[model samples]
Target chain A: MQITVLAGGVGGARFVRGLLSHLRTRDDAEQTSVTVVGNTGDDITLVGLRVCPDLDTLLYTLGDGVDEGQGWGRAQESTRVAGELATLGVGPDWFTLGDLDLATHLARSRWLAQGLTLSEVTARLAQRWGLPDRGVRLLPATDTPIETHVVVDDGEGGERAIHFQEWWVRHGASLPARRFTVAGLGEAKAAPHVLDALRTADVVLFPPSNPVVSIGIILGVPGVREALRGTRAPVVGVSPLLGGRPVRGHADACLAPLGVEVSAAGVAGLYADFLDGWLVDDADAGLRYPAGAQVRSMDLLMRDTEGAARLAGAALDLGRELSPVGAGTRGPR
Target chain B: MQITVLAGGVGGARFVRGLLSHLRTRDDAEQTSVTVVGNTGDDITLVGLRVCPDLDTLLYTLGDGVDEGQGWGRAQESTRVAGELATLGVGPDWFTLGDLDLATHLARSRWLAQGLTLSEVTARLAQRWGLPDRGVRLLPATDTPIETHVVVDDGEGGERAIHFQEWWVRHGASLPARRFTVAGLGEAKAAPHVLDALRTADVVLFPPSNPVVSIGIILGVPGVREALRGTRAPVVGVSPLLGGRPVRGHADACLAPLGVEVSAAGVAGLYADFLDGWLVDDADAGLRYPAGAQVRSMDLLMRDTEGAARLAGAALDLGRELSPVGAGTRGPR
Candidate 1:
């Protein structure tokens, strides 16, 4: 089966890992292939190095190099570089980057400076982590910069714009965001294989990533939403919330800016136009979804890999049930 | 006294530290100022960050951040970034860069990318390290890259050119170099304040650094030689060799390729045209210097900071003797 997943940072990585784990146990597991469309809205250049937080999170987590405790960054990473940078006063003191993590940024920045596109650089980086051997392919949502910026109160008089990272990481997303705007969205076209992935996949999944910044940003790309609506494959989404609160991260803070209620029903409403199946946590079973979508409530607490796999398995089964009988499965590996 | 030292890497750093220490105890020390013209030929860009071995050697050694036992690099440094880079197969495995050291390079590279000259970048880096507060000013010989390349036997009966680091650090300079050439030397002009320091200095001393690569490369810069010869200040040089062998490093290997004999007298010959006084170890007291240069013998082993200070003091006294009466020492602070 060819499974295409739209993902964000830590949460997305966890879901993808669980999906891969779930596929491994299937009778036809050897024939299964996964392609992940990673959000690039959180990307930024820090200290002259291009850093794609979401893509790196997925790559490190899936490649078995992630700091398990933090669910992001490299295992056993040191902040010596950050400390030294602080001494030099070269970069912002807010964002803390680890020494081992810097190697990836350095490599990516060099390759990008040599004129490689984001998609090409992502492939090169993934190749080093042996993502291909694991039957997983990761690509950015768009090749061009499509950085998300939040409009927030400047604490003086007028409102000002700040990069998503500063808004989320530095401020802890505490300040009320007036709205979110993607700087390069109007000019950004989907990466080469993105539309094709939707067109050819047996099923497409939206992991429990932040709706506004993650899946929302990916869908904002020009032809991406149209492609999803036009594809014959069933589209499914899993709620990032459990009992009206995000299972991980501050999705409610993101949702507030869009005036969307911080509930499973509110998240489902954002994807209702094309979503064929929607899965909410059992805690949110009382909530209502749109008419055309088939809603199912399951235990969505991804407390461990096993729990994550079970949730992923539930989403896949829902997708299979919604798709046309023979079209539910992919032909071969 | 205003002192200008032509220096490179470890030896130069040691001499400067000692010189600083010696000045601290002098009655006129408060008036004393020192400028170190560091060799840039040994510099290399590894993994996109500029690595100035000579200037960094002086800065770290003087600023109390150098690995004392090694005479170079950061004290208490970690190689986490290098290890990660190895895993990614990004840069050559031969040149090991520590995490703390990489911060300096990254800062420099970022500044250089912003169109800051190496001299400006060096000053900024030095400021952070508090080199200025230590009464030391470090400047590159030239702003343009003057990397030393070695032509060596490629082990297949044909000659190949490799960077000096690869020749020295990787191969341990085991292969006999056919010749040494400085890339961009013809185009490289003296960095800002280089000629000015030489022009207005009370005395100029050549530290016991590699004569062929360190002090030699500095003199190769177009106007530097002219400034040294034309300056009214007395020029003094200390032999890197002691008892017919280099005190440290492979100065002999480099000198042999240029047909310069690996001895104290031979080293003094290279500087005789500009040098007024020369210092050598007591072991080489019998060796005669060229006609115009006065010679002195001393115990030149810088076994510790105290020994280095004493040697520096002896060089200053010798320079004072060579200068026309009342022309050597600077006015009071």
Candidate 2:
């Protein structure tokens, strides 16, 4: 099947890993194409270099270079960059830039400085990593600088803007957000591959990413939501919140501030107008889906690649069921 | 009394380490001011980040953060950047940039983007290491960009310009240089402290760095050499080449192609016009000094801090002897 998955951070990476496992074992790799539209919400500029942590994490996880233990950053990473930043007394010490990871930002920064678009830069980076042929085409949400930032009300009745990573990684989404912005997304064009994949997709799956941030930020990019909404493909969303709680991420914390409920029903409602099918955890099978959208239940904990593939397969089955009988069922049908 | 030293890379850092050791223990640091004028010849703008390996080495060595095992770079380093770069297919990977050392480059690169002069940047970076106030200042030779590049004759009979680092660290100086340029030094202004230290010093010392690329590049910076020559201070230098071999570094390899002998005499000739005294190794005690310069012999190994201190003391003594008959030393006058 030709699957197009919209993804966020760690949860998204895990989901995609599972999806890849499912597709790879079905016939041969060439029979299926998985294109990922990755969120750029957690991107940050540190020491004058642009760092897209979410994009990199997805790439590394998919390319077999990710640190399995950390869930973010590269494996066998060193803290040289972080240590140096500490010596300089730069703030936000909790979120670090690894030395090896810094190389990616440096190369990306250099390429962008040379006038390459984010999409082009990402392609070059992926090529270098020998990750180009992974049956997946990774695309940034947009081909421009679009940072997701949160505005939180300071306890004394004032509000402040924080970079999304600072709110997500540093603060762990403990505080309520007044609002959030995918800054500069209004003018950003969906990266070439992103729009192309959506148009050609047989099925579009939403990995269990954050509703208020991750996947939300991608949808905020001007042409993206329209593309998904207009595609002939059946779009299936996997619930990030299972059993009334977030599976792993801070979706509850991020959603509550935006008045989003942390449940399958809440998430389904958020995407009801676009979702053709919904995949909730077995624990949340009691939830209901929109009138015409198909509903399914499965073990949602993607603890490993095997489990991820299994859930991915289940989600795909539901997607096939929801897809038009002529363009659904199997193998890019 | 104030003392000033013009320095370059490995040898220069070792000399300063020794000078600091000697001055702090045997001489009165309170009454003595030591300003080190460092070469920026080896600075390279790699991946759009300006990296000054020599200056960083000195800073880290002095700050007690140097990776003594590798002979350069930082402690607890990793190869994530290089490994990732290789994955990216970036070239010129012969010289590895350790993860920890990358932090220094990132911080420096950010500051350069902020429009700070390298001298000012160095000063600010110095403060972070909790450096002691012993009237010690590490000043750059010039405030402008002075990249030391080598013109090498390609096998095809044409010449190509290579950055000094690539030529030195990457190629291991295996190729012959048609010519070298401290590029753009003609229009560059000598940093304020460089001239001030030279003018106000009772004695000036040259550390045993590469006679051509290191100390030679410093002199090429306009106003710097003139300031040293025009000052009332006694100028003393240590021979990087002891007997017919370099005390350390690839002095012989770099100088041989230029028809410069790799011996104490060749090193003395490079500074004959300005030097008042020259320090050769005890092994080269019989070696003659260049015109108008007095010759002295000492153990210049600088194996450890104490050895460096001993060498520093020897240089100070030579400075005293070269001063007007019976004239006192700068730091221990």
Candidate 3:
């Protein structure tokens, strides 16, 4: 299967890992190529070093470098830099940089300074650790930098913007944002491989990543949404929301700002144009989509890599079934 | 009393800490300025962040922010960055950065990007923590970004050039460097206040830092040695070496490259012409100096702030005792 996975942070990374494990077990790994388009909306430049929190999270997690404790940064990390920054009175104190994780950011920043695009940098870094090549590839959504900023009332009546990382990682979505903007999206172009990956895909899988911000932001990139719409392949999306709320993250708060209900149906509507199939949890099987996008419910929690691959396999099967070659297609063929 | 101390690394920083402590205990709350001209030989841009090890040592030691474990960098530091860098296979692993220490470099890098000089950046950072105003100043000896490179035999009888930080920190001075070059020293000028500070000095104290590479390199700066020679103030130097070896650092090896002995007498001879008094350890009291210089012996081991102050006070006292005024001469009469 030629699969393209639209991803966000921890959840996306976890699902990718699961998909890798399953592909390896299936013995058809050589045939399946997984292209992950990562979210860069949470990127920030702190003290002059550019930090891509979500991208790093995905890379570290999938590369088996993630700290087991946090499941975000690398394992065996230390917070020496954070402590020093604190002493210097700089904060979003809640987020800590593990020692092992800093290396990725440093290398990324160094490479970026040397004139490499984010896509090129991502490819080089992934090749360094040899991410599962049997069916796996990681790509950034755009060449131009895009920052997701949330506008919140700055303790008074007036509203100001805070970087997405600060709002998500630091505030933990405790404060509500009046609105959100994907800054620089006007100038952003989809990564070189994104359109090609989407067009040639047998299945386009939207992993259970942040909908309003992460995967949504990737789909918003120029040419990506259009590519998916024109794809001859089936498109399936796994819902990040389950039972009308997020298992993690403030997706509900985020959804409220966009007027999207906190349910699989609500999220499915956002990707409704090209989504041929929607995967929700068994708990939300009772839910209905008015436009009647082919829907199924499964055990969607990716508790382990095996579970992630299981969910991936099921989604792929559903997408295949929904396509012209699938069981649900008309008998004309 | 305005006091200027020429410093290198650990020993120099400790001595200045003592000086800062002594200044605090004075009967009068009047200004007791301390101008520290820190050695820049060890400076190198690793992954492009300028790190000043010795200067930061002095800053952290005096302000109670130093890591007591290593007596350098900040306290409660983490190593997430170091671990990550190691994983990424960056060089000079021996000169590792605590995560907290990286914040200083990152902040300094950021400030430098905004057109701030190292001196201005250092002052701004010092102000954040409220450093003692006895005119506390940390200067980089010169404004130019001159790097020190070491040439070592390449095992095939040819010499290979490596940065000073790599040679010293990584190799642990195990390999011999045929030469140490402070590239661009001939054209370098003492950063604005250096000459003015030295010329107006009531006393000049050379802390027990690596004299050959530290103080020697500073003296190599154009118009700097001249400033010291032309000053009416007495310059007193404390020996980094006691009997024949340095208590810390590979001063012995550094001196060998310069054909100077690793002894109190050797250092005294180097500074003799412009020196007023040379302080050696009591064990090295019999050490001799060149013509026209007085010699004194004291406990120069600055184990803590009290020890630092005592040594600093001793240097100050030696300065007054050797000067024309204290000697009851009419302005060198």
Candidate 4:
């Protein structure tokens, strides 16, 4: 079976890590291949180095090099480069690049500057992390340079736009953004193999990524939404929200501008056109979901790897139930 | 009085630091300002970041942030970024960038990409190092991108060119070179203020930097050599060679391709067209020098800051003695 996952940074990385862990215990582990399409909307050029927050988190988390406490970045990371940059006043003080983490940006930036596509750079980075050996392929949603910007009041009754990172990382998403704008989303084609991964997958998973910026940004890529809606795969997603609140990050703040309710059902509504199975926290089990979507409720708090694996197992079970009659048992389709 | 110095990396930086030390003990210290024109031939883009080895050495050494033992890079540096790059197979393993040192390149590369000239970027970097406060200004020889390429036998009866850094750092200059070709040198104009610094200075000094690749490359810039020849200031130089041997670096190897003798007199001859005074080690005190150039002998081994200061003092004294009667005491020429 080929599983395609759309993911963001921390929460999404953790969910996919759990899914991989869950798959490891299955009889068909060797037969299962996973393709992850990572969101690149959070990408920013910091100090002339390209930094893909979501892709790096996925690489670190799955490679077993992630900081368990922070759920992102490298384990045993040091901030020597960041400290030096601060002393030189080169980059923003709030967004620190760890010494170990900087190597990723440096490699990515170097490769990109050499004219290699982002997908090519990601593949090279993935090799170092042994992703291929684990039957995992990570790719950016789009190769085109795109960045999410947040429009906010400039304190003069006018609006101004700041890179999403400043809004998210620096301001903690508390800057009351009027709206989110992706610079190149409309023109960006899905990266190589991205549409194919979605179109040909047996199961398509949305791993609790931010609906407004993460998965939404991926869907904004040309042909991506159509691929998801047209794929023969059973599309299952875990809700990022529970009891009108997100487990982490400022999901509510992101949804507020769109006037979407900050609830599991509201998030499910965002994917109503293509979603097959929807898993929500037990606290929101009574909420009504979109028609044609199979709603399931569970204890969604991923407190540890084991808890994450359990949640992933439930999502896979839901995907199996939603799969068409002969599709669930069929070989690579 | 204005003093202009033509310099390279380690040796030049140490000499200038020593010169600053020597001047501090003089009553006219507050009245003297130094302008250092650093070689850009050693500059290379590594891992997509511009690395100005010579200029960085000057900054770190003069800023009191240099690794004293290595004579370059930052103090208390860590190679976490380099180590990570190695793990990712990002750059040449032969060259390593310390975490603290990488920050300087990042800032420089960033500023350059943002449309700032190398000289403008250097000024910002100098501000951080408190260069202005010390009445010191460091400028690249030319703002136009130029790199020294070493032509060497390809071990196949053919000749190929490699970056000067690869020759100097990677191969340790062990490879026999046919010649040195500086890309962009012919078409490059001297950096803003560089020609003016030389033309209007009261005195000029050459530190014991490599004659072939350092001061030689700077002189190769258009108008620079002419500026030196026409300048009213007395030009004095410290020989890079003593007893037919360089104190550091592969100066002999660099001079071999040009068919020049690797001796104090030979190095003095390279600057004979404008050189008014020449200082050599006590061992080369008896060597024959070019006509019209004043010769002085000194214990020129700069084993420490004090030793460097003593040697700098000797060079300064030679410049004073050789200066035109009215020129030596003039203010800023």
C-alpha DockQ of every model: 0.77, 0.65, 0.53, 0.86
Root-mean-square deviation of candidate 3: 4.0
State the lDDT of candidate 3 residue by residue for A241-286, as single tens digits: 8888787777888888888888988999898888888999988999
CAPRI grade, predicted model 4: high
The alpha-carbon lDDT assigned to residue B322 of candidate 3 equals 74
* lDDT by residue for model 2 (A121-221), tens: 98887776555677677888887788888999877889989888888778888777888877788887788878868867888999889887888888888
Model 3: DockQ against the native?
0.53
Q: What tens-digit string does per-residue lDDT give for candidate 1 at A28-89?
A: 78888899999999999999999999999999988998999989999998899999999998
Against the true structure, whose TM-score is highest?
4
In angstroms, give how far residue B210 of model 1 lies from its true place: 1.1
Tell me each candidate's i-RMS in Å: 0.9, 1.6, 1.9, 0.8
Clashing residue pairs for model 2:
A1-A331, A1-A332, A18-A308, A80-B100, A128-B87, A128-B88, B18-B308
What is the alpha-carbon RMSD of candidate 4 to the true structure?
1.9
**Which DockQ value does candidate 2 get?**
0.65
Tens digit per residue, CA lDDT, model 3, B1-333 = 667778887888888878877867876436567888887767788777888887788788767788876778888776667766776765356778777788888777778887888888777677655664544777778867777888899999799988887888788777897888888888887887898888877788898888777888888888889988987788998888878888888888888877876788888878877988888898898866677767888876767777878888888778888777762121451
**Model 1: residues >4 Å from true position, as ranges?**
A326-333, B154-158, B327-333
Better of 1 and 2 by lDDT: 1
Model 2 stretches astray by more than 4 angstroms: A128-132, A282-289, A327-333, B25-27, B67-70, B133-135, B253-263, B282-290, B298-305, B325-333
Kindly report which residue pairs in candidate 1 clash with one another. none
Candidate 1 per-residue C-alpha lDDT over B126-226 given as tens digits, one digit per residue, 9 for 90 to 100: 89878889888899999998899999988899999999999999988888999998999999999999999998889898999999889999999999999
My TM-score estimates for the predictions, one after another, are 0.96, 0.92, 0.86, 0.97
